[model samples]
Target: MVRAQVLHGRVLDAETQQPIPNAQVGVADNRLGTSTNDDGRFVLSIPPAYQAARLTVALLGYRSHTQALPPLPGPELRIELKISPAALGEVQVTGLVEGIVREAVARIPRNNPARATQLTGFYRESDNDTIGRPRYLVEGLLTVFKPDYRQPGDDGDVQIRQVRKVDLRPAGQAVRIDWAGGPFIAQFGDFVHRRAQFINPRHFRDYAYRLGPGSSYAGRAVYVVAFGPRKGNSRADCEGQLYIDQASYAFLGAEWHYTAGGLRRARHSGASSRQLRVAYQPYAGRWHLKTVWWQTQARLPIGPPLNYFGEFLTTAIDTAQVARPGYVERAQTHDVFLRTTVAYDSAFWAGQTTLLPPAALRQALLDQPRQQRADSLFRRRRTGADSSTVGPAARPTPRESGRLGFLGRLSFGAAVGLFPLAGAGGELAVRYTPAGSGFALRGTAAVATPGPALATSFDYQFVLTKTLALRLVTTWLHGQFEGEGWQLGANYQRNLRPGHRPLYGRAGLAYIRQTVAYPVGTFDNPDDALRVAGTKLGADRLSARLQTLTEAVLPTLGLGLELTHQFELVADAGYLLHLRTRAQLQLDEESGFFLTRSSATINLPNADVDLRVNNQPTATLPWQPQHWLLSVGLHYRLRP
Candidate 1:
């Protein structure tokens, strides 16, 4: 009788000692394997077919670990993974990078899969909009029949096993995503299996490279190569880092992004931007494409940022490449944007596979249970002997559950700003955002005791992409200090972030119109004291002006400790525009009622600059009084 044993383990980072979730663990030639869960724990059933086989554990950005079959006196295994040394340091090695590339090119076939294999995979995708919300998400299970590894383009076929999805399309979105054909897109991302679909093997000489230190992958060392277009070659190009297996000179994985040259060359290609990555591992004997991730963003000429993100995670379930005649015929192969299966079978997924099922997916299939049946299966296996699986009623995840309706998309917020000389004021605001939609509307009512005033504002925002937006605001106010004022403004801001830091650059144009209250005859006398000037007056006067301005400023980027997901620490610092302040003198003709009179536009002192500051009588800001605005405040926006 063959001996079978069950094993449990947790994977962790060697240095941080923190659990590393999503690590893959299995034995060579073994029929069963599993991935660590959120807590970095996994349970594996050692199949009798490979009781003596060694186990392999791997994760992205870390060195892989290998060990003999488990049950080495202990009931559980704890694996600590160290960071890959290849990525630890960076040094210029351009010649070395080019040499490695040459070697990898010649040995591509030997380093990659030689035969075909059947793969079971889970694909999930999510998108973050301008507002930084996970508004769109999708997942699919697939069965892929790959052709010979060397000839990836010849004919790899895919069939969807099951699918699930959720989308919160921000309201009034004219652009609704049609994910019906995304499965094929996922297939194209398999640079190892479908190698020819994206980058060409023969074009390696056209790019430039810079080599970094070697790193560990799948228990082997790999050269870290960074490459992009060379010199004045402004043509479209792929630029990113690559991991090349040092022994066989095969590319184990790569993370690539498009460069400006690439964008220029592909201007007519209908491709805007892409961030892609793919990795492979030795699965069921030979190398199998383990993971493929790609996110594409649509270029907006005048619209919101629209993006598609796809991930493909594969496990070798079976293989039949040698027995098959040629490749699956195009006519026989299924082609599609993956559609969610209207009905899901709970038992089908419960069948053992190498990879752990995603928790959200299991939750969807298990009749909306709070916890999955798999978690119970593990518990029973741990505590009770001779465990049997339990199946739930079959049904599709509710369609209505994915929708974020009117109230769900509404966000309310409040803010208070110190007006320096004018005193403190607060605003109550209501904002509405449609899921995945790039548009938002805000209505605000404000009150200030020092200004002893009441005001209201209506604002609108439309995002063009991650770093850009168009803002429109109109405000009406009445008070003793501010007088009856109405302001209309619009700005287009481009926010550029510098890595994960709080520093960012902002450049935008703005238009402003407002009414300013000041005592008459208060202008600093400049007409040579000898000349007679206007007499002093006790009555107040109102001056309404319109200004068109452009400014460049730096603002902070990133979030504060989230008391609530929507609560944020917001801050801004920058210079306002320097422009002519134009207005008609509406001096109080009688009892504080202003009458229109001829007034000329004013410039800053010496005409060099009017440094927009609170004390500058000629300057009026859209929000606050200070010439140079610096703001740090607690901000909350409804996220539900």
Candidate 2:
């Protein structure tokens, strides 16, 4: 067992009394250490043997320090870190209008190139005309994990899959995004990089100025940057202010607005802004990025409105490879974004892969002794157990019970009948099951009319294993021309091939009642002569239907296709039933001939009609039909 002792201390700037968060402290020989917390307090758990020796303290933006311990040590030590002007690089440029990018870039040591991954965060405002006020807000977080490729011949080919999270919500509720897709990550990276390129250095050259007296961020320089389209360059989506730390020449933070625009005006034009404050400290003779706090706000014209505020905390840096013996380093980053009271956290850990060629890797493996290689490969396969063992280890099994489920069906159809007359019908049904129960409850509603009809229904289905189910249905229908109808039905269905192609065959018996009312016509009106015979009408029907429905999901593309057929038994059994029907009828009267005759109706029963609809259904039964649809289209996924 290893024994450890605690060492505690606080870090403060030598020139200013402000506490320095994210200061690194560690034992010289042992690996135990931690960065300063928000309050600048840190505790290092040193191994027992190292407690009696001196401890090293390092801050990224400040100079490093070492404090020797007293002969007999206590649990805590007090240390003061000094600011060295040379240790912290001098400010090469400072101003509000436009700082000198060349000067700032010059300060970064050529010996150790600074590299970082970029990400974008966006928010937008929403407009709701129906409510007379904005109703919802949408926020999104996008990250781009790009490796440094400053020179040619560097590894340029990279994998594009890297998505963080997306959150969308109304103004007050919490937001969340499911991070499962890859293409989204690439899109976000492209957006961020494109905006980065639009910010003109010339704008900063004019706007840059030194800090003014009485400014809260005084002593810290500022610059105003402008971003717009250039000749042959696409329009930029960003513009903002950049704040720099004069002492260390590091970017303290920036505030900017982003909008999507082009040479011609576009519908999407809005602003997203952010403020970032960053501080660095010197540790072990090297300056490292310490703490960075970022807050963002955005206004979008799409959907409802949206706003977001987030902050990131960067901790340790480890170098990947040691060029010289006894030297080692690596890098790590832990970041989190906050919105109101909720926070989402993510971490990234990466190291340099071996640069050896394939031939070298093969030679290295071959260099190992044959017996040793065999042992390494088969280590996990060797098991110590009785060869005759045939049963699993003793363990308690939880009771297995099937859950209650529901399936809903919505159907709609339209028909054109005799003489400028049309009929439309819709039906919606929902069925539910109870655990281990053989019966289910169903409800339904339906509507039918000469011109337009509406219907609704609720239903219940009791599922028996994978292939059998029982259903009960209740339906109500109303029509514009026809009065109303009510139906009660029960069905038994069996499903086959539930894996690839699902086939369900159902037979149901239903009792239906329909009623109609018509206005009486005056005897003098010859056009209304037929109405007198049917001043009031009613119909009662008993029907039975057998239906076969099949649906298949395209395994590779995530698409679905369905087919259904229904056989109806109505009226007298002797009458031939039509599977699908098409009918046309016309009526005309010839007054010049001194007689009136109605045209005969023609009916083609069970005729097929092709209709197109969305793959997903709407909330309402028989889901609403689309006004227009595009068929035979192709979709492509692009990544940056």
Winner by TM-score: 1
TM-score of each: 0.48, 0.33
Q: Show the lowest summed lDDT stretch of 10 residues, model 2.
A: 325-334
lDDT, candidate 2, 1-640, per-residue tens: 7555455567777667766765656554213244565556665545567666666666533466766644333644566676543321343433432334334434444311234333222211222223222222212222223233222122112121222221222223332221111112122222112223323343333222333221112123333233333334334444444434454444433444443342123222342443334343333433333333333333444443433322322223333431211101111111122111221112211111001112332232233233333443464346643433222221111111211113213222221111112334354333323233332323344434343224333344444433333434333333332222333444444443344332444444444332221111111112223221123111111111111111111101111122212111111001111132222111122222424333222121112211111323222222211111111111111100
lDDT of 2: 0.31
Tens-place lDDT per residue, model 1, 472-551, is 53444444334232222323333243322223344444454444332222222122211111422233321223222222
Clashes of 2: 65
Error of 1 at 90 (Å): 18
**Root-mean-square deviation of each candidate, in angstroms?**
21.9, 21.9
As a whole number from 0 to 100, the lDDT of residue 11 in candidate 2 is 73
Residue 294 in model 2: shift from native, Å?
A: 1.7
